[model samples]
Target: MPSDPNRKIDIECDVAVIGAGTAGLAAERSARRAGARTLLIDDRFAGTTCASVGCMPSKLLIAAANVAHGIHGAPQFGIHADKVTIDGKAVMNRVRTLRDEFVSSARESIEDLPDGAKLKGKAKFINRDRLEVAGKIVHARSVVIATGSSPSIPETFDGMNNILTNETVFELDDLPSSLAVIGAGPLGLELAQAFSRLGVEVIVFDEGDAVAALKDEDIARTLRGLLEREFAIHLGVKVRASQTGQTIELAWSGESDGKKRFTHVLVAAGRLPNLQDLNLASAGLDLDEHGTPAFDRRTMQCGQSSIFLAGDCDADVPVLHEASAEGAIAGNNAARHPDIRPSKRSTPLAITFTDPPSASIGAPASEDTIVGVADFSDQGRAKVEAKNAGMIRIYADETGKLTGAAMAAPQGEHLAHLVAWAIEDGLTAMQLLDKPFYHPTYEEGLRSALRQICSQSQVSFGPDRDEGSVPGV
Candidate 1:
């Protein structure tokens, strides 16, 4: 197949944004709004991994699996079905359709941006403020590197011919009968559960003792329960060796008893930054000791003030939302030219769409404050909806200031917005509790959790009484 024609352009802009993923798109819009001439460049003309292969494709498959699981397991809910089977080919076709829709919709939004900014084939730094794009050289006052990441798999194990990662997973037409997912983080767990629900016998392995180690323990446990009910879990394990056949072979280092076992493996480890082709040394930008762009967190200016870094390439935790947020800041900083005022608030909220879903907002809390929790099983709405197993946990300071909120429940995605609002506004637990919440709603669970913490805090420490230290109260 012939490659797409390079849309050549030789021009100068106030801001040149690289990578047209979530962050790059946001940066271009923000820079244009700030009255800066911006140019956006990406390797994928239609969509990159996140658009075509990563997020969209995975979610599409997961959605189908969820529906299939619901129908297959409906007998317990008193809903009768003769038999339920998943058409693997049909599922993959639907995923392709959704992916195409994403590219179409994304293009419409991209076209709405300022007409001056051009989306080119590829972008690489020639000098500090100069970039080579699509056989044309362009200069800008400031450049933002928003190039995203690609899936990374260690080469210790063989059989990549059968082992699948996020990049190649979408290319699969038929589901594996028995599959082992390496890495029990968000991606691994999500895919494991999705495949299990789709009737694939799935297992997950990871170096960590539990999945989603960075999340709150209670929330992770709840999500783990849902996954365990569907898939086998091999924790604190490493891929040692592998051999492929009609059924892919694998060997792993078990966490307990230090035993090595064999199984069929699927690699869902994580992503590595895409910076190999970009000659950063020419622009005087070098990777930090951490292997990421060494940039001032406050300014996002890498090496020099003229070149800004954004997205997963510069983030401590990589995600679409965080990338876009940082990209906006970078674009605004880029527009400011020489002198720039950076944002003080840099908190990130993340969500994992496993079974009931898991979400977290703000920084974690010290062990001293009481960690208030409300189970969704106690909520009237969840009980009625038959999704009452998850829990909501909130951390608050002595003065009732919201510290953090984490939820493992159905509609946790919706609950996250309220938590984000509370954290952003610095709402007190008493204030949040007193607010009128609609009865029998998932959000009412939020109000209930805050009220419980407020009541307990008041009772534990009387008015004008000095409180002694208690372990999370």
Candidate 2:
């Protein structure tokens, strides 16, 4: 007899991937390419965090703030302009419009998949190799868990209103009269500065004294000083919030304690993975004290089982590039199951999108590594741009391999990439110095820092000496 049309059915595939976010999409594609019948599942077909409400929208807001900032600072260059006005509604409208385009592009990839290969529903593990999606059963030889993550609201924020996370902040119809940003991390500080520049009365509060997780003391101090010039930052304290009518009252206790009220509070503390509904216990994997399963980060595998974990689920590195790399690794491994491929992760690189910007690359320095310093306060390019408030430190091992570096410098994003590439390629400071260094450029600051490491390591600059180069010589 034929099966009833109203009844659910069981389906089988070589691989089942949970979540269709950035990492999940990559995993599904990679698994299919490896000759596996793959199934991709998501709670909803929303675009990636980067395109939907994270990087793209945040950058759009920053771009608008930068234009207003430039106009305000034009007088320093002896340039004058009439009164500048920022239409908050128009700015947010453009952000949402362009952001939707990016999200639509990401959605196209999943839409192109066969209807049977994609399912729109939450996936729960019935067993090690079985997932129950809606009423249908999906049995797979291997499974990849890449559910991504979501904004983590504190317990104190429960039942609270007018609180904004990175995901919800971009949806605002217009800028608020005031914003209280809770956290001095990258996300918090970036938005705090952007909103301040765009005429929002902003105050940042953080339990930690430092900004953006920088390890270097000097760089952090320099960055904090520069930022303080723009707005207030209260650190070394825990802030409690209470709603009062249309305002949110924030109270903090520390060296300097005070209470301030704002129209809204932005919680940029961090993000947590979405795993509550997965019913992980059914997988029967050995779980950690935190309930996370033990897995090899390099292979993205969970113990000896065919199940794999990737992306923000591991919470090891939450950056987009790291997510993509981990997704590919997990996908290929899930497709090949009992025989996983060798995986080599690249050097770590991170950037904070501040006005002058800040970046960190590779690992932090140990006592044995020599350090090189550059003060962009005297940098020609920075002075010319009127953004001379910056510093950089380069770390190299005794053998001169560029191990790590930290910077609160202008164009540090580009500098961090160069340093990361050099570290990844095992290029020593002197070897990198052998390359060209343009005059009157921000990269010259990098050369300055590299020279210090080379000098400390007794490595000589052969030819094309940066200092010897003269214009029109």
Per lDDT, the best of the predicted structures is 2
Candidate 2 accuracy as TM-score? 0.95
The global C-alpha lDDT for each of the candidates, from Candidate 1 onward, is 0.74, 0.87
Backbone N/Cα/C clashes per model: 0, 0
In terms of lDDT, model 1 sits at: 0.74
* Top-TM-score candidate index: 2
Residue-wise C-alpha lDDT for candidate 1, range 1-473, written one tens digit per residue: 22222434378789998888777787878888888888888766565446776678889988999999888868777989878878988988888888888878777777776676776667776767777777677788999888888777878655445667887777777776778788887777778888888887787877777675446877877877777877778777665654545554555676642333333456877777877767676577667764666887676777665988788877466777777778888888898877777776545577777878888878775776657787777577777667777888888877777888777888988888788888788887777765666656777777656756776664333465323211111
Clashing pairs in 2: none
Pairs of residues at least 3 apart in sequence or in different chains that clash in candidate 1: none
Q: How far off is residue 205 in model 2, in Å? A: 0.9
Model 1 regions more than 4 Å off: 1-10, 111-116, 119-121, 256-265, 344-347, 456-473
Question: What is the C-alpha lDDT profile of model 2 across 281-398, one tens digit per residue?
Answer: 8898887776677899889999999999988887788888998888899999999989987699999998889877888889898889899898888788788898887889999988
Off by over 4 Å in 2: 1-9, 462-473
